[model samples]
Target: MTALDTEVAQSVGDIRESYLAQVGRRRLYSGLALLIFVVLMVSGFNIADERNAGGFWEGLHQIGDYPGEVLTEAWQKRADLPGLISEFFPALVETVNIAAVSTIIGAVGGLILSLLGTRGLAKWPRLIPLFRRVSDILRAVPEIVIALVLIFILGGGPVPAMIAIALHTAGALAKMFSEVAENADLKPVQGLASTGATWTQRMMLGVLPQVAPNYVSYTLLRFEINIRASAILGFVGAGGLGYELRNAMAWGPGRFDEAAAIFILLFSTIVFFDQVSSRYRNRLTEGQAQ
Candidate 1:
């Protein structure tokens, strides 16, 4: 064969070899991943078995006793609906209150933070990093940890939980609000600024309108998360269904029915709200189309 033909054949062989190498690499990665997963499953089950000393299997054998009542058992038999709605619902209201109040507080705090975060607003330059860092620190802490600490100082109940959720919410909300402020149509803000509009006025007239729907959507979304958070806080004596859930589980099988019942109710309510929120979201975006 000519030198050109030899070179062409060599190039084809190189391409084939490269393709095989890539296929080999992918297969090797897949095999390693499967091995790691199998090891994890085996180890996890062994650890679980050691801890339970076969108690888990024993409990499963007795599943017939805890038949249906999902809500009570899930929340744990810590509360029945009559007792729950009458006594704990108020605490539930308190949780919702905390979420609402915190959201508002965070919204306001975030507005100020947003101003500092935005380059145009943070014209002073030195304040930008300061504001960003402050929010970073605030956002870095998890809400649950914050609540745990606050419970130590403030002495349990919804107050500490509220403070914790609020702090975290503010950090997150402010960061989002600031980012939104930064990215809004600058033309509207510029137009307002030219008309001697105050910063608040410009935000209200220009920025807010542009971002209101998104803000509302996020708020409702957080409310859903807060419901779950509040439920968990109950486990720590924050006073809600979660407290009952822990109690039921602590009491063992007999209480499982009640805990399951509460879960059914709690989850059902959350599902209802989610449906409502989804409808509202769809309605809001109706004009925009999918």
Candidate 2:
């Protein structure tokens, strides 16, 4: 073959080698990542098992025992289930109320945070990082931890749960809302600004209208989450259906019926709100599509 042909063949060989090397590197990186993930999972499980009182495997096998006992007793006393449910209805209401109030307050806080943290809509653009960091910090702490801290200071009640959920919700929603805000058209905001609108006025009149549906949609979703959070907080003395359920469970055996009643109430309420929120979210999405 000619020298030209040999050079061309060498170039082709070089390209093939380069391609193989790239592929090999990618595979190596991927394999390393997977191995690291598996190691972390195994080690984490071992640590947790070591820390557990009953041993993870042993406890896992018995997980259903308590639930089965509770259900059997509850079924035996099914005749009185209606009365028990009625007795705990007010506690159920309180739990729902806690969720609702928290969602509203959190939505408002998230709205402000979103607008302030977003690039295009921030009133104080220089402080965007500060706002974003604040959002992160708020979201990092779990609602239960916040509730416990507040409970220590304020005593156990719905207020602690509400405030705890609201703070976490604000941070969670802010992150979501900022993403939506980032895509919003800037023309309306500019128009408002030209007319000497204040920062709040500009956001309220220009940005809010565009993002309101998504904001409401997120708020509704957060409300559902907060309901569960509120109940769990009640277990720590936040005073709701969860508190009643905890007391019933603590009584053991004889009180399983009451625990079952509270469980049913909490489950039914969650399902009902889930359906309602889903329906409304669909409506909002359809309206936006139109």
Query: RMSD in angstroms, all models?
Result: 4.6, 1.9
Residue-level lDDT of model 2, residues 1-290, one tens digit each, is 69999999999999999999999999999999999999999999999889888897778889899999999999999999999999999999999999999999998899899899999888789999999999999999999999999999999889999999999999999999999999999999999999999998999999999989998999999998989999999998999999999999899999999999999999999999999999999999899999
Top TM-score prediction, candidate number: 2
- The TM-score measured for candidate 2 stands at 0.92
User: lDDT (CA) for every model shown?
Assistant: 0.73, 0.94
In model 1, the Cα lDDT at residue 95 comes to 58
lDDT of 1 at 158: 78
Best by lDDT: 2
Model 1, 74-181: lDDT tens digits are 455443545644544554566566666766676667667767777776545678888888888777888789888888888877777777776777677768777766
Question: Where does candidate 1 have its weakest 10-residue lDDT segment?
Answer: 70-79
Counted clashes in each candidate structure:
24, 0
Compared with the true structure, the alpha-carbon lDDT of candidate 1 equals 0.73
